[model samples]
Each structure stands twice: as structure tokens, then as C-alpha cells.
Target: MTYLPLVNGERTYLATWMDLYSRKVVGWQVGKTMEDELVILPLRRALQWRQPVTGLIIHSDRGGQYVSAELKELL
Candidate 1:
């Protein structure tokens, strides 16, 4: 996950999408923003590699980064 750097103190964000069935990482992205779409990039990449995400269950920490109006709408 993205976090503040101790030395630089920059607010960073990390986004990752994983597959529940095989317990494998599907994809990931990194940036400095926390908009709802922060998690979308990775999700899209994962989707391209697997079948439809019909039964996918996305789970993560309750950080504002994970819960956003755009993400709620987009996902």
C-alpha cells in the first residue's frame, strides 16, 4: 500500500488487485492521488488477464483511498 515517506514525507498511494481463487496478485499501480480511480487502473489490468470479474470480491483497508465516490461509482 502507498504511504508517507519517512524522509520525504510525501503522501503516496499504492493500488493492487488480487485473485481470490488462486491467491495471486493480478496487477498493481502506484501514484500520489487518492481519488476513487486510484484503484481502478490496477483492477482494469487484472481484468484483462482473467475472466469476467462477475464474482470478484474486492477487499482492502478502509482508507479513504479505497472508498471514494468515483470508485464506488466506477467499480
Candidate 2:
């Protein structure tokens, strides 16, 4: 996952999750605040839609949101 800052004058965040094997975006979410939900929502959506088997590996930068206790529990 990654956070992208939009160039729309006002600050906006775009969070995305990609499937490395396919090199395609599996899920995404846009929000005004850079909160944990920004990353978690996309991850939950991807899990619900793709339903990958166990032992799935998710690679992401060491952002605070990714390391949060809530997110760790979810994973």
C-alpha cells in the first residue's frame, strides 16, 4: 500500500493496494485524512473481493497506519 498526494490544491490522500503477481490494483480508497481507515478499508475490500487463500503475503511500506494494532489484528 501507498499514500499518494493529489495535486488538486487542497490536500487529499489516495491509498492503493496492488497484487504484485498481477501488477494490478486490487483495491483503492480516497480520503481527505491520512488515517488508518484509509489503508484498512481498501485491504478489507480486497480481501472480500479476491478471497485469497491462506498464507497470503501483503507487502507495504512501514507507515504508521500499517503498523497500527487494529490493522495488525485485522491481518
Candidate 3:
């Protein structure tokens, strides 16, 4: 997990992603907006270091960040 100070007086949000099997942190990013794009970037980076995340169990807080329509569609 990563905590990023909000810039420009925006709200602070944490983005977390974990790899179930390895119990290792697979992806994380800190930014002002809880947009799906932000989450996808780190996920993309993590995936770059491994195989397809088809069955990977990714868990995160029930924040707007993880509940975006685009992200859910992608998932």
C-alpha cells in the first residue's frame, strides 16, 4: 500500500493491489483522483513482471477507485 499526499488541496487516496498466491504486493499507486486509469497503470506494471493475471486474486478497499465502472468492466 502507498499513501500519497494530495496535491492542489485534493483528497488523498491510497491504491493497493496484492498477489494472493505469493502474498506479495503486486501493484500500488498514489494519486489525487481515484480514477481507474491510475489503478490500471500500476496493475499493468505489475503484470509486466509476471504472467497473465487471469486467476490472480486482487483485493482492495471498497473505495471509488476500485469501484469504477470502467475498471469493473475490464475486470
lDDT per residue as tens, model 3, 1-75: 345555666566566567777788777777766667778777777877766646766677766667887677756
Query: Model 1, range 3-36, lDDT digits (tens) per residue?
Result: 5565676668777777777889898887777665
Instruction: Give the best candidate by TM-score.
Output: 2
Candidate 3 residues lying further than 4 Å off, grouped into runs, are 1-11, 57-64, 67-75
* Of candidates 2 and 1, the better by TM-score: 2
Model 2: residue 40 alpha-carbon error in angstroms = 0.1
In terms of lDDT, the best-performing candidate is: 2
TM-scores for candidates 1 onward, in order: 0.64, 0.87, 0.58
How high is the CA lDDT of each candidate model? 0.73, 0.86, 0.69
lDDT-superior candidate, 1 or 2: 2
Candidate 1 regions with alpha-carbon error over 4 angstroms? 4-12
lDDT digits (tens) for residues 13-71 of candidate 2:
88999999999898899998889999999999998999999999988887998998888
lDDT of 1 at 22: 84
TM-score, cand. 1: 0.64
What C-alpha lDDT does candidate 2 achieve relative to the native structure?
A: 0.86
